[model samples]
Target: MKADVVFINGEVLTVDKHNSRQQAVAVKENVIAAVGTNDDIKSYIGEQTEVIDLEGKSLVPGFIDSHVHLTIYGTNLLGVSCIESHIHSLEDIFTDLRKKAEETPKGEWVRAWGFDQLEINEQRFPTREELDQISTEHPILVIRTCNHMCIANSKALEIANMDEHTPDPEGGIIERDDNGQLTGKLIENAHMQMFKVASYSSEELSISMKLASDAFIKEGITSIHDAGAYGKGSETLRIMQQAVRNKDIRVRVYAIMGSLTNSHDFVHQMVQAGTVTGLGDYYFKLGPVKLFTDGSSTGPTIATRQPYTSDPKNSGIIYYSQEDLDCYLGNAHKKGFQITAHAQGDRSIEMLLDCIEKALKEYPRNDHRHRIEHAGIASPDLQQRMKELEVIPIPNPVFMYVNGDVYKEYYGERINVMYPARDYQEQGIVAAFGSDAPVTFVNPLLGIHAAVNRKSKTGQEVGEQQKVDVLEALRCYTINGAFASFDEERKGSIEAGKLADLVVLSESLLTIDSARIKDLGVELTMVDGQVLFKNEQLMRPSGVRR
Candidate 1:
């Protein structure tokens, strides 16, 4: 059969069930037509076929980011970056915020994202008083890297009606000074409420989604399990579908239903509407019922069984009681909705497992792929439970690279079990790697690097025994991710019948210096047999040869 496109003379990592490798692959329509040696695929290359030579670069399955916030990622891309690489001190942040405030009209909102208090020179969140230095007329909100917390100026707080007298809401915290005045720090639900007010309009959201989709293609991410949208989960799904309809967003999205709050009762609404997971087409599908068991891993609010090393009084925060969790998950489980929760800490993971185990006892579903978003600290017992329960751990190993030092101090020896990828592989558990973008950046290569190297950005080793080989890491990003979404058979590999989603890389990750794997670049990204992103400068020595 004549093919649409044929790629030859390169290292092709099919990332199939057996971890197969090929020399060439041919695409027909939206699926892979053939995968074999260059000579074997030559028969499919007709006169009209576009044949491109890879020279010596590498090709692999397109990345499947299992957990990411698309809306937040888009907003971050458009906002001023305050990440450690960009700003070193609070003064730098203030200067940027001031500039934004000056440009924005009075009484308008000013925003900045990705500030890690640990990375800043001051080593603490910028107080509300300091943000007031930017503009009292305009509300300012600076988000922490964790995305679970934020520091808002007095204006924004006043708009939220938060004061010392405003008691901390359930599953959230409103920090106050020793003198009982608002400190401007909002955690969990408090942060979510403020974000709701400061959120973008539908028009702005469409633009942001487009920008984020463009960036994802550049990074070779063809499919995304969008963790959740910003506002009401249902509304977020609608906006995402509209973006896909408008062709503003290109990546296949499996959208988790529900926001961080319980006020919406999205699960109840979906069940009432007779909806279940996997409810849409390939471009946009409704994923599992979403819930949060705990807060951010790096923020030290992951609800561990033991107290944090740095704070002996605090063992972290779990959002729901056992009865509440059981009610939420059990209802969804019986209703045929695959359930997933943001359970990062050991205690939180245990809580979720308890709920799942109880639900299974009452109504057993053989293939329920209930998932834990971070599974940040998976103890041996917890891993065994997860294995027996067939629970999926969507762990982000890249967290170690970005926040390993803090983890070391917070968890001490328990750090060895944090993101235990090797243990997951050995135990035959399907653990997918996610960036948890907007919490961190959305580069799968960095995740792979952290998984293989088990080292931090500062070269500090973490859980060395948990390191997996490059091939294992790739599967975690590709096939494992597909398995989590129950789409394993159709995509995630370069098999003949699979979706024609592939990425051409600047270097062979299999043979590259493991230390340098994160530096490997994407030369091209293809989705549904169409080249969506191509780096002209990196497209060296390639031509359509008849």
Candidate 2:
């Protein structure tokens, strides 16, 4: 009955059912008690109630990244160069690698990520010989931005005991030279073998998870859906559970367990253990069963309908066969588990759509809300079917900015068709926006800009025709993201009875120029009637409730 906090004198983009705008919002405990004019909100402002003046800052729901690699992003936060280094030539990469190798202990593994050969205008992956020249004693591994591939130094390969005779694992590739020598490039599932050999300890995982949680809080992200947690067993899930239990995880997590060989059995056990989706409090929840249909376009490994323009000989590989995908989806659907398939290329998306269609026909369920993560290149037919089937498309707009050049080089004039955002919207499909963090920075503003602009980070227009408006982009990050996760009724908007998970921004996104949208900063972030973050200079009211 009493108000815990009242935010006044602000332009509130409520994103409510009526898409209403309000001047004030009153919060009681954690849920929003009232949303109206300042006069209407005054009744709830008791003497004990904390009142904060926004000074006309724009308030919206707290940004939710539907897809992110939380633990991996946290681990990369402590890694060496390559991401920040502008590798003009292979020598520049080598120089940085040598420096990192020198700093690392002699026998300790040297790890790095976010390297692109295209950035350096290289035609091939860096060989083990080049890395061996730097340090034969230290095991070195660098993961590509796509995460589908990695370049391991000879020492790392030796440590894994991977040789030319090592057969490529199912659903993966171990690139070998024409002379039948290992070229240090591991793709898809094969990368897992080496990674398992060089896996981090539980202590290291805990540190990384904590670091990532801290970063998420700083970024004003109250919740995130970790795309997939990889490894044998539910180690990542257990680590997250422990963090939440210890009160170390400041941000809530929805962890999607990666598909396993024994997924049916594992999922059955998880269900029996009461690990169903949406089973936990705000701290954590068991999410969808993640299945990868193909690799990434950054490596030109997304199984496209046509051969890649850059590599005519390759049309990308399908990680899961149709039969395997159907089996996984059918079983998961029957178990009432939502499925989030990583489908990028047209062929991959087509296959996933087919599998979903078959699943729907065989075992129909209402409001399935199964998602196609990174539905990058959906055809018109697929888009229409996605609407009819109620499939969610969680697209990464930041990918347009981060990998626009790669798409340009790989698809040439067909790049517009690659990420058809406008087409999806026109077809009435629910296209949610996400950053796919660690693949890109976790900035919702940047993603909004990219979605509305379709421009590369270098300020070049990649797909101007595919751009949406600012409001539509905002909806994607807010309401649409919530819809994808089936939390729209409880969160996402600044409506009465909804949880007060809101963000106050320094600049009004609606009034800002589209070109400068990415420059907007969060002035405050509040979750559950609590001020989680406020600008350093801003003073909070005394005697605020914990």
Extract clashing residue pairs from model 2: none
> Which regions of candidate 1 fall more than 4 Å away from where they truly are?
84-86, 543-546
Q: If scored against the real structure, what TM-score would every candidate get?
A: 0.98, 0.92
Tens digits of lDDT, candidate 1, 1-546: 999999998899888878988899999999999999999999999989988888767899999999998988997876778974668999998988888887888987788899888888899888999998778999899988888899999999988888889988778899998999998999987887786677777777888899999999999999999987556667777888999988899999988876865633776777678989888887888888878888887887889998998899998887889998898878889999898888899999999999999999999998889898899999999999999999999999999999998889988989899999999999999999999997897999999999999999999999999999999999999999999999999999889999999999988888899999899999999998999998887787544465
- Model 2 lDDT tens row, 138-178: 99888777767889989899888899988887768888989
- lDDT of candidate 2 vs native? 0.79
Q: How many residue pairs clash in each candidate?
A: 0, 0
Q: Candidate 1's C-alpha lDDT?
A: 0.88
